[model samples]
Target: MKIATFNVNGINGRLPRLLEWLAEAKPDAVCLQELKAPGDRFPEAAIRDAGYGAIWQGQARWNGVAILARGADPVETRRGLPGDPEDAQARYIEAAVGGVLIGGLYLPNGNPRPGPKFDYKLAWTERLLAHAAGLIEAGVPAVLAGDFNIIPTDQDVYKPERWRDDALFAPEAKAAFQRLLDQGWTDAIRALHPDAIIYTFWDYWRNAFGRDAGLRIDHLLLSPSVAGRLAKAGVDRAVRGRDKASDHAPAWLTLRKA
Candidate 1:
């Protein structure tokens, strides 16, 4: 199956661009982040018309996540990440498509380090780690894909020096990301193209996209049960340059069928 992850930025504003990409790329399943719309306001009909059915966790205008499966309706396996009853941001949604578990997440962007937002980001990462441990224990083939909002390593970002103080690439953030990897999940993109400078997200400021100044924040992490089946992975960088396109491009991986 061809599985992809993309941060569409905003579902309503990027509908046309999203449809165009979806038709051209034709992935079997897609995990979307940053829907930025309420559940009632999601363009369900439009998405259905595009030949996919989705399960989404939505907030008004901030964090949101969804999983869209082509040719199959996704069965929701879980909603928000557990461990924090007070946590209410629509950041996580998981589902099963043809026996493959897929999860989409929009991790918080904790900017202005040494602040409350940064603390919340770390706490959220801990919660996600706890939840991921549970999923790993379930022993199912799964892929966690989305905008993690954490620049994992120097290789994952354009310049380590430039992002040193940035929240996304902070030492604490990188450690949290490493903790996830240590849990027996394979970073699918890195597994396929270890040395390639593949990037999936760029800022819409100061001509970042045009300059190829981007970061590989969006990712597809596969459990060991599914990692051996990995066939291919890539970033649709062209999509980031399209008219009315999102700051992020689609990152995808294809896996051999069991």
Candidate 2:
């Protein structure tokens, strides 16, 4: 099965580009982040028309996530990450599609470090790691995919010096990201193309996309049960260059059939 993840930026604004990519890429399941729309406003009919059904957790003009399955309905697994009772951002949603457990996430940006937002980001990462451990212990083939808002390593970002102070590249943030991998999850893209400088997000400022100045924040991390199935992984870099495209591109993985 093929699984894909994308931070569409805004579903309404990027519908055309998103539909085109969906048709061309044809992934079996897609995990979407940053829908930036409220539940009532989700464009369900439009998504269904494109031959997919989805479950979405939305908040207008801000964090939101969804899971779309082609040719089948996704069985909702969880709505938000456990262990944070007061947490309310629509940043996480999970589902079971075609026997694969998939999670869509839009981790906090946590800009301007040494602040409350940065603290929240670290706490959120901890919760995710705990949840991930639980999933793996259950013996399910899981794929946690989306915009983690983290630059895992120097290789994952261009011009690492420029991003040193940013939350995405902060030492604490990178350490939290590493802890996830240490917990027995495999970074699919790195496993597939370790030496390739793959990037999933390019900022609109400074003509980043045109200059190919980007960061590999979006990712697909697989649990041990599914790690062996990794066949191919890539960033649809061309999609980011398209007209009215999102700052982020689609990142995907192909797994061997069970």
Candidate 3:
């Protein structure tokens, strides 16, 4: 099975680009972030025509998440992250597709740090850690895949020093990512290309994509059982340079079918 994740930026505005990619890449499953549309406005007809069934947690003009399964309907699992009843952002969604539990998330950006937004980001990650632990204990075949909005490590970005002050690369954020790895989730792209300088996102300004200045934020982290089947993984970097493209390229992994 080929599983992929993409931060579409704006689903309604970018539907054409997304549809084109879906036709060409043909991933068996995909997790999408940044829908930037309300629940009632999701382009269900277009996606259905593209031959994928999807379930989404939609919000207006900010954050949203969705899971799409090629040729089948995704069985809805969960709508939001646990441990936060008051939190109402549409940033997390989960579904069962082809017998695998897939968690799709769009973690908070938390820019202009040292404030409430940054605090929320940290707290959100804590919640994620707790839930991820449960998933690990259950030992199900699963994947946590999405735009994590985290740089993870110096090796995961180009010119790390330039982003040191950024929230995505902040020590606290990186530590949270480490805690997830400590729980035994395998970072699929890193596992496949341990020493490569792989990246999934590039800023639109300053010719970042042209100069190969990018960051590896979007990711597919696998539970142990699912990790064992990992065969190949990579970023579709070319997609980022296309006309009317999103800043993020699709990060994908292929696993052996049982």
Error of 3 at 202 (Å): 0.7
lDDT tens string, model 3, 123-186? 9999999999999999999999999999999999999999888889999999999999999999
- Quote each prediction's TM-score: 0.98, 0.99, 0.99
Q: Which candidate number maximizes lDDT?
A: 3
TM-score of 3: 0.99
Cα error, candidate 1, residue 193 (Å)? 0.5
Error of 3 at 58 (Å): 1.0
Cα lDDT tens digits, model 1, 160-218, are: 79999999999998898888899999999999898999889889999988888889999
Which regions of candidate 1 deviate over 4 angstroms?
none
Colliding pairs, model 2:
none
TM-score of 2: 0.99
Model 1 residue 211 distance off true place after TM-score fit, in angstroms: 1.2
Q: After superposition, how far is residue 39 of candidate 1 from its true place, in Å?
A: 0.8
Candidate 1 lDDT score at position 69: 90
lDDT of each: 0.91, 0.93, 0.94
